[model samples]
Target: MKLFLYVLSLVGFLAGCGGGGVDSIADGDPSYVKVRESLREASSRVLDGLRIRGSYQAEDVFHVSGCESDSKEGGGKLWEAAHFWQIDEVNSGEVQSSIDRLRDSLEAQGWTIVDFARPPQVKNTVVRAQDPKAGYVVRVIGVQEKSRVAVRVSAPCFRASGDS
Candidate 1:
């Protein structure tokens, strides 16, 4: 009985790994293009605060097959919309200052800082911010040794444009 109970508890815990649970509901969006554009614009605002500018290349990853209803019957299979820009040509020396500007920018744009870690605090540096009202998230990741940065903007769980 103990082992069965342990397995059940573990299952419950694992369900929330990537922002799951009862509230993990997907929003309905009619236009996929609009959702894509909006997320890109939001990401650009975060980069606008950075002290350094690098090439912005969109990943164009639409239809991320995870955003779905957390209902008991699992009626719909929704997907998360996400856009990513990889900034190249940024050097390691500029990372620190860039992050500083990034933080200020995030605040100016009304984003709540979700996670932040830098050198001396930890080896790798990553910044995550979220727009509560808009349900959009932005993440900045940089590795000193790599000399490149990646920025990602993701929309909340949304059904495919077809569902509209």
Candidate 2:
């Protein structure tokens, strides 16, 4: 009876230790999707305003900025974590002005600006806009207690024809 109990206990322990049985969560969740959609909508609005002001251009790529990092947590290491957008730009002042309007627009949409800084990885230029330009990331916690969802949007400035 003692040997049998020991065997049963070992089996129970082995079963309990199997992979934790937790559901793997997808990185892209609904909240993140919604945030991304909202940002795209906001981008469209900015673009429309720029167009109305005669600054829209087809060559521009609205750069959304974020971060990458490697750090250890628990027994594992986290490879990357994107920060947020930090700037916006266009070939004309009208596009820049439209992006400037984003501060209020995002706030109204339930996002709070945590902070801002010029990313060092980018080469700052008086004429050309930096890559991963300027903007902010909006975040929401997921259904899982530790998960997060975010959307980043950025716009970088470019030179007009006359300026050197």
Best candidate according to lDDT: 1
Worst 10 residues of 2 by lDDT: 141-150
Residues 24-65 of candidate 2 have per-residue lDDT tens digits of 112243332333344454444333322322212222222221
Per residue, candidate 1 scores C-alpha lDDT tens digits across 7-104 of 33234323332233343323333454466557646655755667575544333233344565533445455656666556667877887678777977
Tell me each candidate's TM-score. 0.70, 0.28
* lDDT by candidate, in order shown: 0.62, 0.29
